[model samples]
Target: MPAEKISSLDDPRVYKFTLQKDKELARDQEIIVDSPKVVLRMMDAGRTPKAILANQKFLDDHGQRFEGMDCQVYWADVPLLEKIVGHRLHHGVIALAERPESLKLSALGHRLLVLNGVNKAENVGTIVRTCDALGVDSLLVDERTLSPFIRRAIRVSMGSIFRIKVRTSADLFSDLQTLRTSGYQVLGTGIAPDTHRFDKIDFAKKCALIIGSEGFGMDSALVGLCDAVIKIPMRDHVDSLNASVAAGILLQRLGAI
Candidate 1:
């Protein structure tokens, strides 16, 4: 369809583009993405937008992309666009798309990262982007954590969000058991002296690295479930590393990708 010019704040057609909390959007399995780059990356992942709102000038410069896609494309002046989105105007375009379907544990590769109640969006995003770069096959996140589809997380992932496979586990313990029985070594991150140092072990071909909440480390149950617990060797002065940084280090060492 041709670009529909948005003229007024009262326009019903552009209503979905109006802002809402990311949590609210996630409740409906929907996400509002900023900029043409993110939208383009999302499309490249074999997904289509439900609608796109672009500044008129932005559309003029890059209109070819919207030519035949199956979605609404609306352009408006900066002032009106700001009002519609309830924010300062920037980034030429924004798109609304549903979250990609979640994958099953059985469908993922041998190298996986399991997030147990990780609370920060930035941490999640950084870990995801690092996972994409290092060839970590997929991510398994427990439901207690923030959704990776949250807007802040999406922004931080820098388009890697669209490229990674993620599975949400309702029963993380049971799922870990299944993975362990399938010849996978479940590794836990911990600070205990007896925990195997990351460099000391021969990392398994099929391994799941479990990272727990930042404030509270892995709870007792999860630690007990793991076949082995591992720790990064660091100076005694530095107690712990940021979750994302640690993830990058471990994944690079694992070379499972």
Candidate 2:
């Protein structure tokens, strides 16, 4: 039997060499790139030598020609890297690659999840992760929401944020109107008495579930724009779940339906 070839980052064929600022290299080097490239570097804080070596070995064996360029490797201590990136949690490994394009609402095949005023990056990341898990077609981020690509959100989502389609709308209300015109049933989440139980809704129909901020529920005008208002039944003193948690639950139920 022939020895199978192993791809390595060191292979000149595996990567494209480029000059990047040392600061940008640490924050999210992998995601910043335009191609399928991984950035390997040493972090200043709590440097994990074992992880770094492991990453190097893996990159050497499996990395594709990084757009026919060289892989960049940088060295920095914990304090300097943190100062450069404006945050501390690099986990000793970061890579930037081309992310899948955000899916347009018109191109979506089934149900959608729309986020409004959900500014917390972690929550946004969680919702995206859930969307991927529940087989939701796409995610819509209103202009007021946080960026799902932020490092913290990406970390919290375990990179699932990259797997799902994310689109932003400057005028969310107008976007909802467009969805309605396209025959999507816009379902808004809230606690009002008139809201329908989540289980009662028919998820088989092309639908869009709207989740509002943790502090404020959906905007009144947006709620009125939805085809229906839905709520998850809860017990104990729980009035509501976190935006991400609620979204996950709703998506799961919708998926089951």
Candidate 3:
């Protein structure tokens, strides 16, 4: 069905779809995509939008993208749309898309990323984008990791989240141990006595690269469980790199295989 044009900001449908105050309200069932570029990417990735809110101008210019899409496109003035969404609608567009199914560790490839305590949404999104660009097989995040589906994370990733295979683990440590037993050399990003130089890692075998949180590095328990702790050679007394930056470097190197 074509989008039902709506002019009122108070429409119950608009209220239900534009749950800005509670970003995670229906996260399990639906995701909100702001900006036309992201929305278009979502559609191109075969994701169907449940509803779309945009100004008539936006519809006039970009509605063709949703030409045959079976979804409602609510039209409102720019000001009204802004008022309803609690922020300036990027390009006067926002979409409600059904969330994709979670991936399984058993279904992923040999090269995978394991995120331990990384909780920053932007970092998570950046890492996802990096993983996509570097050709990392999949992402395995622990319970404490932020959801990449969050609006800010999605925006930061520039729509790459939809392209990556992401799986969540209830017990990250146990999963890492399991990966070790599965022939994956679980390598944690850290500085330890046995920490190998980043460039020296052998990418021939299957491996899981572990990235930890920003404030605190990997917990000792996780560091201890690693087949090896890898470190990027730095100078000028730099102690560490941003989690996302470190992941990008590691992904680029390890994913080369």
Candidate 4:
């Protein structure tokens, strides 16, 4: 499809493309992917966008990918595009898509990373990329977790979120219990009297690892529910690591990378 030109910011089709508070966008069910590279990655992941608003350069380079795609395409000058999105168009492209229906919890892949209370978008993004790199099959975000589709997260994730199976779990505790009943071990990251050294944990089989929030650790109830609690053995002076850094280290061990 030829790219439609977006001249007016007031154009109804471009409303969703315009910039808004992250809170508002997070509440919406749509995923807005920016950057030509990330947009292509999303398409390669088999995500058909509802619409695309981009510049001519993006079209010139990759329009063929949309040959038979059933979606609206639009383009505008860089300045006008920036005005619409309330930001500089470093990548000169953006795509709006509806969140795809998630798979059932029982249907998720063998290895999973469950976000318990981790709420930072950047951490979630980095974890998304880490999961993509380390072979974690899916990401399960609990109710306390923030939306992974936030623009910052999508940018930080480098489009890995589009490729990964992610689900915002309504009931993570019960879900984990269900997974455990199905022969999958549920692992939580934290340091407790009974917690095992992360490197010593056997991750050879099906497992779901839970990452807690940055400030507080995992919820006590969730911690009690874990098949085992594991922790990164660090120097005595250091109390804890950044959420993303800890997740990366754990994931490296999780996938044996």
TM-score of each: 0.93, 0.70, 0.92, 0.94
Task: Assess candidate 2 and give its lDDT.
Answer: 0.62
Model 2 off-target regions past 4 Å?
1-90, 96-103
Q: What is the Å distance of residue 159 in model 2 from its true position?
A: 1.3
Error of 3 at 168 (Å): 1.0
Clash-forming residue pairs, model 1:
none
Q: Model 1 off-target regions past 4 Å?
A: none
> For residue 188, what is the lDDT in candidate 3?
84
Candidate 2 residue-wise lDDT, 1-257, digit = tens: 11123233343322221223323434433333211122221111111211121134334553342323433433244454334334452443344443344556677655788888998978987887788778885788887787676555666665566556677788889989988888888899999778899888776477888999999988888977887899999985889899998998899976654
Scanning candidate 4 in windows of ten residues, the lowest lDDT window is 19-28
Model 1 quality (TM-score): 0.93
- Tens digit of lDDT per residue, candidate 4, span 74-114? 99999899999898889988888876666688768888888
Model 3 misplacement above 4 A: 21-23, 26-28
What is the lDDT for 127 in model 2?
86
TM-score for predicted model 4 compared with the true structure: 0.94
| Model 3: lDDT of residue 198 | 78
From the highest lDDT down, the ranking of the candidates is 4, 1, 3, 2
**Cα lDDT for residue 245, candidate 3:** 92
